[model samples]
Target: MTTDGFTTCLWFDGQAEEAAHYYVSVFKNSSVGRVSHYTEGAMQPAGTVLTVEFTANGHKFVALNGGPQFKFTEAISFQVFCDNQEEIDYYWTKLTEGGGEPGPCGWLKDRFGVSWQIIPERLDEMISDPDTAKSSRAMQAMLKMHKLDIAALEKAYAGE
Candidate 1:
């Protein structure tokens, strides 16, 4: 881990480039940085994609062609902090397209089987409100949501 920056490497079954393209298209401030192909002497077949570098909403990531031996799980996910409902909706819709599945509490699995958390920035503050009752209401609201509703959370926090 260098102080220069950090990258989250994603393992794919020979879909590094495809996944990179998909991610770049979905994220607001994202793009593919590099695409490296394997050559002779590599574990994968020659001329196959080896690794890809990309940015999803400014987060550096490396997608590797590590074969299908491993898979993405719910244990890890990229959490996107959004300012409002529109941002949340955009992310949720784009990320859950194709074969993606929706999960409780603003979690969803993309077509590539990558888990994503489309979270509202204010949700944390509301859930940790100084008033315990307000915080409890916020928590209850959040637990019942698939795609977070910021207004609903605010209303609940206000005991309405």
Candidate 2:
């Protein structure tokens, strides 16, 4: 991977343009990129968009209105490593707009049906503690919640 970074392409049935714009509006440092369309009599009509490229949070993504043969699954997800609770809460709230649902370990599905994991960077230390008892407590604490609470994780790690 170059310093330029990598981008992920999301396939939408026919809402590529709309979805691209929506995502660009959400994250900072985001903008819609090139838009290409199929020529007349091509696979799709001339005015019909063939691809829409967009960037969000500095990550690039292409939305292809390639029909409905594929859909987003839980197998793939975006991970948001939050350094503080405010950031976590902000992302969680914004992401859950519409029909998004919160899941364990800070996992959530956005209104657009995109899965995301909003977690604190400190979680690695808490879960990877050399002490098995502390690790167990942290795991238990983590399993019971949807949006991860950094404070609670820290408390558990400290045996508080």
Q: Estimate each model's TM-score.
A: 0.94, 0.89
Clashing pairs in 1: none
Candidate maximizing TM-score = 1
lDDT (tens digit, per residue) of candidate 1 on 1-160 = 1335788999999889999999999987898887888999888989899999898888888999999899999999989999888999999999999989999999999999999999999888888879999999999999999988999899999999
Model 1: weakest 10-residue lDDT segment is: 1-10
After superposition on all CA atoms, how large is the RMSD of candidate 1?
A: 1.8
Candidate 1 TM-score to native: 0.94
Candidate 1's C-alpha runs over 4 A off are 1-3
The 0-to-1 C-alpha lDDT of every candidate, in the order given, reads: 0.91, 0.86
TM-score of 2: 0.89
Best by lDDT: 1
